[model samples]
Target: MLLMHSQVKAKTPPTGLMSNTEQDQQFQVLVEQHKGILYKVAKTYCQDESERQDLIQEIMIQLWQAFPRYNPQYKISTWVYRIAINVAISFFRKYQRRKSSVDLSDPPMYITEPENVEKEAQLQLLEQFIHELRDIDKALMLLYLEDRSQAEIAEILGLSLSNVSTKVGRIKEQLKRRFSNHKI
Candidate 1:
């Protein structure tokens, strides 16, 4: 399912709040429409399935909360993405801080199956490499995956075009070395 946030950039948001039933229906439609964006955004922020699933649920909750005051004048994709980034960054930081003590954690705190051997190895290496990147590199990767334009990325991330250009160049070099080294 996907959400309605696809490229429909808005000049002014929709003024009215949706009724509970209407909101539910709208949310259902959005979920059916834009689930892929949600999934990708979640994956970028998390290293495991449980966390990814949690992020999706969390995004759903945030969407519900934001729906009432949703300024539809803006592109739904942009607005939803702002929320997704906020949530993912905050959640990842918090989880990292918890230090993941076993006593307070669930038995199934992580899932290890890869669905396939090749996918498993690739994911393992990818995660390791990604974790070793700088914060800006991570943002670049996220924007790239979203297919955002250099201008759009600059706007969303508040970077100068030249600065982004340089960083992306550097990120490419680092990523190449990462792959070549075959070490995290």
Candidate 2:
């Protein structure tokens, strides 16, 4: 079970609105339910372990700040994706500016039993390829791989359905060429 850290403190609710305790409870429930998405986004955007955790924390903070303005008409996942992706993109930009060169070293492997070595290898290769994509494309590909519908992806990314379709097709072609060239 995912638990919100103590760092996520209850904030003052808007006047004539839900109580702070009620708002915090609702936010906690939502965060717990969607934490996996947060983790995936953070990992995809930040390869450094410490930076990834910081990104996740930043994402949660931004989510809480924006929670009061959240519109229920949208799907919860869509809202989460929007906030997470925006935070990730901003964080990526800031990190890029701060560092003269980013280390592209292979990520640490975590295959203890080695039962699915081939599968793990393929996943790592895919992750490497994903990290090479542009920020928006990375978000789109992540959402697609997560089995989000194209419509949902379009909504989250603020792209038209046809544009999302085109981008996915192009992204797949790019990935295919990259894999073939790399002989993965």
Candidate 3:
């Protein structure tokens, strides 16, 4: 159960027309609908369960704060993705810096059930490959794997469409190499 009930509520309603209750209700509904985005972004950036929870909380707080300025012209998912990815990247960097100073042994947050051991191993290897990527490339791969359009990814990550396409191709080749090396 992802903690969607954030303690941080918008201090003021977006339009100042709706009561706080109404605003909270509306925000809750939207967050609930888009909760999967939060989960995936958090999972991508955080390997430890506690760290993932902290990242999710930070993302939720950011989303709450930015809710007022959310443009209606953009899809909600796009906006959510933008904010969540940014927050996750920041969190990951901070965590990395702290980790560099302290040699903490982090454990995997979750493991696949033994339904198919080969598939599980492949998934774990893919996740390990993803974690090996640089921050921006990691974000790009996440969006690409989610099947987000290159244009949408460009918009979210503030990169040109051509840049996104090129980087995605490069990242795919890198992943393929890593997998092949492991296979042999």
lDDT of 3 by residue, 1-184 (tens): 1222332332223445666676677777767777788888887888876667667777777888888787656667778998999899874444443222212233464555676677778888999899889989999999999999999999989999999999999999999999999999
Off by over 4 Å in 3: 1-16, 91-115
For each candidate in turn, the TM-score is: 0.69, 0.79, 0.79
lDDT tens digits, residues 1-184, model 1?
1234444533233335445665576666666566666766766777675666666777767776876677765566666666777677664443543322212112342445556666667666776676566655776777765687777677667789988778777776877787778745
Candidates, ranked, lDDT? 2, 3, 1
Best candidate (score: lDDT): 2
Q: Taking the tens digit of each residue's C-alpha lDDT, what string does model 2 give over 20-40?
A: 786777787777777888889
Off by over 4 Å in 2: 1-16, 91-115
lDDT (Cα) of model 3: 0.76
